[model samples]
Target: MAGFFDRFRKPEPEPVRAELDQAGYEEVLDLIRADHKVPAVKRIRELTGLGLVQAKDLADAIEEGRWAPFPAPGQSLADRVRALLSQDRATDAVRMVAQETGMTEDEASRFIDGLDQP
Candidate 1:
């Protein structure tokens, strides 16, 4: 009976391809050196064609001196929440988000709800 229900669970999202090209490497590094995270993310997205989350991850990695493009999948908080939700652990997911982000319970609930959409 449990096996029957397992077939209907949502699959985890595919990991983002966040490889940075050499063309804009210097410019992106300069932005990071200047402590301009948002602009660095935008520039990374432009160069690598990654999504906002992926670009941000790449930028963070670069800043940390760990610029390897590939890492464990679903490394972001949103991805962790999504993983928990997929496993039918909504309460745990909400609690984890609230604790990690210092969000109120209501805000955390809304944040989890927002993740339900595409």
Candidate 2:
């Protein structure tokens, strides 16, 4: 004597969402996956004393082409001077070009100096 009322309930499907940005942690993870020859993340963290998140962010920026990785802070002034010494007339030394380009010597030095360093 049961009633005909208990046989057709269906479950709802979960909503789909877009991929979330990796921030930095995920980006470092991606880079590690790409190149595992060296423990780069570990070394970088040790040298910079940056937190896991910051380190990862920097790594991500480098990988994404949003930032460049060169001209480490401890580089010598001689190297900087050498780079300025090597430029052609169009791209001469930072101080020399700064006068014509209307850019600050410090700014030009940093850019050209960085290129001079390894």
lDDT of 1 by residue, 1-118 (tens): 9999988999766554555654466578679879898999888887777878878887876665445332246488888778668877686667667767889879999998887543
Candidate 1, after superposition: displacement of residue 92 in Å? 40
Task: Quantify all predictions' global Cα lDDT against the true fold.
Answer: 0.73, 0.49
Model 2 lDDT tens row, 24-83: 334444555578413545544655565566656666554443443234388554563465
TM-score of each: 0.41, 0.29
10 residues in a row with least lDDT, candidate 2: 14-23
- Clash pairs of candidate 2? none
Pairing residues by index, what is the TM-score of model 1?
A: 0.41
